[model samples]
Target: PLIVDASSDFFSRKIDFSNIALFYGGVQKNAGISGLSCIFIRKDMLERSKNKQIPSMLNYLTHAENQSLFNTPPTFAIYMFNLEMDWLLNQGGLDKVHEKNSQKAAMLYECIDLSNGFYKGHADKKDRSLMNVSFNIAKNKDLEPLFVKEAEEAGMIGLKGHRILGGIRASIYNALNLDQVKTLCEFMKEFQGKYA
Candidate 1:
């Protein structure tokens, strides 16, 4: 089983072929809400499960047999999934979504690099996530809250960093447009000018 944090748009990244079974995450950065999780499995693997007598709710075969209508699945969650899927399709499917995400992340990274140590990115440059642009302000112990406040004032919501890693984290999901990223980049420049 592959344990993935798909909630943060990890699916947009390149998939390694070694993965066999992909599990689900309940929150949405890509999936788009709470109480909903999506699982993807290889069809060949399902055939092997035929001999196992797993509980109906726990068995993939049972769920497939019932067409995922098994055991009173969350109705509202399914609706939201459909909505998100439609939006994704309208945006030209996953390829376009990944392209836009890559562009947005590159824009943010460019701004961060231009900050000349005033801005620092959290993820390793090689393994940096395209979805969550995690970073920190130089001397962030003083600049962190101000950066968040200024971002909020500039109409940039959710620019605050994760609690586990204090600093700023801009989650650039598919729903976030390039304009929003440009706005945030401009704000970052302004903040750096004032603080650096």
Candidate 2:
């Protein structure tokens, strides 16, 4: 299983991935850009696949041996990743970052949970995502699109649901601070009052 945890909560706040075969995630979530991906593979597992006929680009050794500079790497994205990492450390490392993320997610989840049948969260409370908050307004499908539109008009963008799971998705990533998250919670409340 590709344990895709962009929050990295397991390592920072909980358990470890010491036994996982591989893990990978795109740069856009909390990294630097959207196109680039950061991959991590177990050394022993990678060695076993050395004789396989996979493309060089897919070969884990090509990246590990070259230190992620194999071929025409996404230089700009890598730079941004470095810069963002430095920025996070300046703000007090993953502990602080995770704390802020938890607070942001809590605000939005509280807003949804307190909606009194007006809004419904996609995941069970225990399974909610810290990176993306997926939900619906009491399964009122029509309201989701309107919410997205009005939210865009109000200066917040990318608050759309997945294509197949059309609903509301408020993705409060590490880059979004507390004030912005509060604004989103406020917007959700206002939208609920107007429609739900």
Candidate 3:
């Protein structure tokens, strides 16, 4: 029954913790691989679960009591998470990550805005996600598939938009560098010139 919205990039934005019982997310974005999930919980809230008698594997207290060394933990995953955390700390922590991600998203949005309605965005302007830039081709429904195809031909992968949203979605996750965004923007401009 815990409502956890671990959708957005953590470093790029803050989560309002007004009434939340727990905060949990996969470490793949700001941290590392998809196999690791990190959780943040209040100690007082944890005390309330003491009488629940959940299975040892499912109980946080069991893991805490054993210092997370209980029953052969995911060693490889934890190692990877440590490596990622070290790398993140070396890069000046989450602040630097946030700054870089913001820059990349801004660059793409600037290009889209300058397109003069040739590029259409899917998400609302205010609610648009910094991690995933979703948009579509304006007035050219046929160009959507071509855009996906040509982007792939240009050495860009994962440019295809999500199925439910349709159109084009550029997921500018933290792992994606600014140079990659520039490369994508160049391709976008080229595609716009050809199809728009």
Alpha-carbon RMSD of each model: 3.0, 2.5, 2.6
Off by over 4 Å in 1: 10-18, 43-66
Error of 2 at 17 (Å): 3.0
**Cα RMSD for candidate 2?**
2.5
Tens-digit lDDT track of model 3 for 51-133: 66687777777766787778876778889889977877777777787788889999999888889898988877787778999
Show where candidate 2 strays beyond 4 Å: 1-15
Which residue pairs in candidate 3 collide?
A: none
Predictions ranked by lDDT, top down? Answer: 3, 2, 1
lDDT of 2 by residue, 65-181 (tens): 898778888778888888978888887887888888899999999999999988899999989888788988785877888999999999999988988877888887788899999
Tell me how far the alpha carbon of residue 8 in candidate 1 is from the true structure, in angstroms, after superposition.
Answer: 1.5
Instruction: Supply the global lDDT for candidate 2.
Output: 0.80
Q: What is the lDDT of residue 73 in candidate 2?
A: 80
Stretch of 10 with least lDDT, candidate 3? 5-14
Cα deviation of 22, candidate 3, in Å:
0.9
Ranking by TM-score: 2, 3, 1
Candidate 1: tens digits of C-alpha lDDT, residues 1-196: 5555566764454466468465555546676677777766667666666766776678777777787888888888888878987888888888888889999999999999888898988888898888888888865558888888887887778878898998899988778899989988988898888888
- Where is the poorest 10-residue window by lDDT in model 1? 9-18
Relative to the true structure, candidate 2 reaches a TM of 0.89
lDDT of 2 at 137: 77
* TM-scores for every predicted model: 0.83, 0.89, 0.85
